[model samples]
Target chain A: MKLTKEDIQFIDTYLENSDVVFADIRMEIVDHVASDIEDRMSASNTTDFYNVFKDYMVQNKAQLLKDNRQFLKSADMKIWKAFLKGLVSPLTPLIFLTSFFGFYFLYLNFNIETFRLIISYVPLIGLSGFLLTYVVYHKAKNLKRFSVVERLAMPFWVFYQIPNIIFNFSYQAKNLATVLWIVGIVSLVLTLMLVLVCVSIKLFKSYEKQYKTLA
Target chain B: MSNSKLYKGSLTTIILKLLNENDKMYGYEITQRVKELTKGELKITEGALYPALHKLEAEGLLDVEVAKVDNRLRKYYKLTETGTKETVNKLEELAEYIKTMQALVNPKLA
Candidate 1:
């Protein structure tokens, strides 16, 4: 079947309904996929616009969807968020490493017991929390469903955490390190879950906004 | 035959009606169907078709499924129950709009 302006309009309608990337992407053409289908239905084949769209969808929607996904995967939010998440936390590991060495030296040469107290907790729980958040960040990046990179990084990026977790691990404060570790891990997980929640909220709000506009 | 303003208004309704008739539809074939049906009266623009389809999907008036066709992944859209009802309402509104226009222009028909 030859494509008409009305048919294009029908496809446009279909895209608007299904694939977000396709809908939000460029639409310089005034004629839509649905209109193409309409034109065809009114033409010689006697095939209704409904049947034609059905056939076309069955034949072409998969490819269109894949293209649509790729278009969305390359979406600015995904890339920008990923990059920003990666960018903002560049110093997390470094800070952790620095504290790790600094504490070790202090333990070797210095008689100061306070540094010992701090280093104990820093590695035990605080470091664990930071690492776990790092893990969550990586997981979020690998999975493209929702946005959850920066919040996970907040604990990891926080300058005081490295020393805090290490210092908490001492004999005098083992329990403190444990508590901090638990909180860090739980917070990281919560941050990840909240990312999904936030995306859901955005999607719902967007839907409501669009539905209202159409209504 | 081409580039008329009157055609644009019914575009969504036409898509909904077509989807109501058939279970689902994709991109290229929908375009082909239009050419075959219109007998060259209307030509759809790709730039326009994609964005509209997405909006309808987002609105929940349509349901989409991704299936493989001809070694390519295709996204198919079918009208929801609400979509079917809306299609009828929209068509009726369009008809009423036309009638109103006729009353204004050709009062004898009114």
Candidate 2:
């Protein structure tokens, strides 16, 4: 049977305020209403649409366009898509900044004598800690628990690399400081990745938790 | 008319007890029956009723049959084996409490 506008109102009123029930019922209405409009067309479907569709929605005359129900999903979709796009889109530029400053300072600060002293005082053992941060942070895809290990690994970086970067590249201890300067560059790259991975994990976990609670 | 509060949490028990007495009922028919039996004192809202039916169906307490009527599909609910057992237990518990309330209220009224 073809439903009139009143028929739609009857069913909608019957469903009351249940949103999901309205969704399920309204899908059936669209199918049947379209089918009824299709069956009566000979001259033009355009001519029939006004007559058939108008009668079907005469009672929809009172409802706001938002009350149309069909547009509900589209209306609620855009804000979230933009928010998530904003969250991860800046990581590349930020990581590049870490790499540039890290490499440049190490290049500017090391000289032969202080670099030699850095070798005597700190050994290459700190490189192992920095390298561990570099490899593990990338390998894990920045999972949350990795951040705790990243924090513990950071101290070894400070002990080995940060102190060894001398301020003046023009100085006489220049050759030794230059070698130690290379270590600083490596540490800067590792440090940025280490911290970025930890920040990413916390954010990823928060997003996951938010979705779980919403569910 | 759709906004009356019946028993706070006993609607399920009431529905089970009523269905246990009869055979099966569709949503519209069940709402009609409750209104008739309760003299319009209990009106189940459609929003509340459908979700309750879905919850009972999920719990394995309600068996549902979908049938077409006059171009519209209607879902009918019946009790599962477990639901029948639950209905009997719930009715017995409610009856005992009613009897206790009657004894208390009768003397106070006297």
Candidate 3:
């Protein structure tokens, strides 16, 4: 009654075709279905593997897929919330405050027009390019494992860019002369904080380790 | 027997209680264990079980470990420290609710 390699393979293909994308979720479903099939086979009434699987899927597929989607969405939200929690926690305030003050100090010290111009463009351009390149490169490297959150990271970065674009376009040179220091400081703090927060969040590390063996 | 809707609300407490007793369990094992414990009057559907487990894990109440067994990867879930503490609170809450329901349903016993 144990599932053979061919049986397991067939189940794997069936799930993939059914659009169960994440390997972790797929593994759980596969195990559940396989175990259910084995149990039915041992009952001695159901002999056909395909029929058992088909019946199980017919009964459970919608709920299974819906649950998978819900779990992924909730997981993504939880990770972002955790990242925000990390940012606002007492432990990390020093890091963000330090960055904030560091940028403010740089603005006060480096008041040159060219220096202001360069600082203004550097972070906006640099961060946008870095995020784009990271997304493209990571997608290219691990296309199969590019999860919903990973794909969503691109649009999320673009959302960040909307503010940058507005700030850059709306501020005149005279306005910049008046508050370039403020602009530079705010942009630097925001950009560095975003990068730091994104890289430092380890909520998914354990899942990533488990997934390494999967897809 | 309880309504499925009523059972759904207590599913987390039920799961926590099971994990507290057993130390670890996988998806199928959990459903089977629940059925065995309930004597088949209650069945934990595949739909309900996996999402519940994942949600608890996301909430940091549970931890997951994947081990290879019989040539396939099996994901096991167990309670975390927070989950252990939460289980006690949830069980107390459920117990009080059950007592209240009993008094309402069987006034002579009260």
Model 3 steric clash pairs: none
Q: State the TM-score of the second chain for every model.
A: 0.86, 0.81, 0.95
DockQ of each: 0.02, 0.01, 0.55
Task: DockQ for candidate 1, please give it.
Answer: 0.02
Give, for candidate 1 chain A, the lowest lDDT window spanning 10 residues.
A23-32
Best by lDDT: 3
lDDT of 2 at A47: 51
Docking class of 3: medium
User: Each prediction's interface RMSD?
Assistant: 12.3, 12.8, 2.0
lDDT of 2 by residue, B1-110 (tens): 25445364677787787778778886656666788888998876444455566556546688866444444444568999999998888888888877887788896643
lDDT of 1 by residue, B1-110 (tens): 13676777677776776787788987555655666678868755443454456556556678766543322234677888888888899889988998999999999998
Model 3 chain A — which ten-residue stretch has the worst lDDT?
A195-204
Q: Candidate 1 at residue A210, lDDT?
A: 33
What candidate 1 gets wrong by more than 4 Å, as runs, is A1-215
How accurate locally is residue A98 in candidate 1, as Cα lDDT from 0 to 100? Answer: 53
- Candidate 3 regions exceeding 4 Å error are A45-47, A88-91, A109-155, A165-204, B1-3
